[model samples]
Target chain A: MSEKNKSDMLRAPFKLEYDYERSTGPIIGKFFEGLSNQQILGTKNGDNVYVPAAEFDPITYEHLSEFVELPETGTVKSFTWIDQPRKHHLINKPFAFALIQIDGATSSILHMITNCNESDIEVGSRVKVSWSEEKTETIKDISHFELINE
Target chain B: MSEEKKDHFISPISLDYNYTAGAATTRFLKKVSEGKIVGQKCPKCTAVYVPPRGSCPRCGVATEEEVELVDKGSVESFTIVHIPIPGNPIVPPYVCAMIRLEGANISFLHLIQEIDLKDIRIGMRVEAVWKDKSEWDTTLENIKWFKPSGGDDIDPSEYRFKGPE
Candidate 1:
């Protein structure tokens, strides 16, 4: 096609935005507040203890109200090494997003694992949450999980 | 109750979308960029739609027949926006009107300019004003605005589509 003909084609930027705000309700609200105070919390339903505080019991379909304080140290349930990181990823360097089961919690939470080589971490590896210096009651408060040598 | 109120947090969100104009819309926009208006006619109801909707909304059938329409049309309804909203394209006190193009049964909403707000009426005749040829593109933005067509006042009954009986 000619240059002038191609120039005739139209293009414009469009953005879809919500003008309103969203409120994180009670269960998830407490989870965020705990992160702000450098604490980790979980919700308990009978025998199953969920880290990151589930709003309802996944198996029972009942409202979960019991809050369990969990230790920062956890074992990696499963992990995958990312060779190249995308722009949206929290860490620019190669890292792993792993399912980590915290101490005293039966269920695992998905979070980034860093501060170690791809070969140094695997299933059942011990890791601890590296809290961010600046916390604002969001998931980013827990910067990433680092390998516990001991 | 007080603890619940203190724990609540507000989250702000924004999103972006890119829509690919399908075959029917592409054809309609191309014609409009060339300073011509076209509509798709419903085979079942014979109702013509400006901006060429691919399907007939009234009959739930695909529209295939293309019909050229006149630039002049009558305003079916309108609202004057006075509230100042963030990122609003037009200023307050501007008129946004639903115009039923001549020979088309359906109405499309667009900005009505070059007329006083107090003088605007439901059946006021308006014509599409094209932008400079250099700025023309395969988009509806080619039409700068709809101005008064200087035609006689059209009765509401004349532009109203009586259902397919």
Candidate 2:
């Protein structure tokens, strides 16, 4: 064995692999079931029904059961610019994901915006779902929220 | 908040992984219990891998040939572990290291025993000290630890040990 051989061995590498599972709770479960039925549902907290049901009532802290249908059209209450997206997000490129308060709903649902460039997105923009001809009980089934014309 | 029955919160954090390994490693552990060191050779690149890998990471092909590596090697890098990791058998305040076996292209981690922690050094020549045959299992721990090879302390800069370049 040569001394040179000892120096080179110090930088050897090792590789490992691992598998993981995630748990989805009751709220997300009901949302998925609703998507499977091709209907979006929300829960009424008090006087106003939220587009996406609250897991826990904001004021009362009790479980909500009242479900209601909201119009697909909604006004973007707020949004964040995603110049780079994560692997599991609906869109992989630059997009505006927003919280939209749909008609007949008091609270907003979190979703992504697509089918247009980032420059066109704004806080008051109207967006609608580009529903799949075939739907599943998942948010991804809606493809992405598309900007709607006034 | 009540004085005797106040609100309390509890949080749970844990790590569990479904550890998977390549076929080559399965064979290596099986052989380790028998007090043998095994490696696989990449025919094209000529790099030997201990705890053999299914494919050559550098050449991008399966390493088909199995080679028996020498039990003797030298410490490439080492650390004095003062903190104990849960599930590790050894108590803390021990020395652990990557030992590059002679004639093999990679290093394997194991405990270093029978030496003062302060005396252990990089490039120290050591050889496998195996467990009694009756206690051998499919684990690297079958070899108790690498004991110092009775040779004189060679200069760290010129300690010639076998391994890949």
DockQ list for all candidates:
0.32, 0.03
lDDT per model vs. reference: 0.85, 0.74
lDDT of 1 at B165: 57
lDDT for position B14 in model 2: 41
**Over the stretch B57-99, how does candidate 2's per-residue lDDT look in tens digits?**
8879999899998888888889999997655678889988888
Q: RMSD of model 2, in Å?
A: 13.8
Give the TM-score (0 to 1) of chain B in model 1: 0.86
RMSD of 1: 5.5
Residue ranges of candidate 1 with Cα displaced over 4 Å: A1-13, A45-48, A59-66, A115-120, B1-49, B52-70, B76-86, B89-97, B112-139, B142-165
Report the lDDT tens digits of candidate 1 across residue range A19-116. 65456778988888899899999999888898889999888889999998989999999998987998657899999999999999988989999878
Please give me the DockQ of candidate 2 compared with the native complex: 0.03
**Who wins the lDDT comparison?**
1
True contacts kept of each: 0.47, 0.00
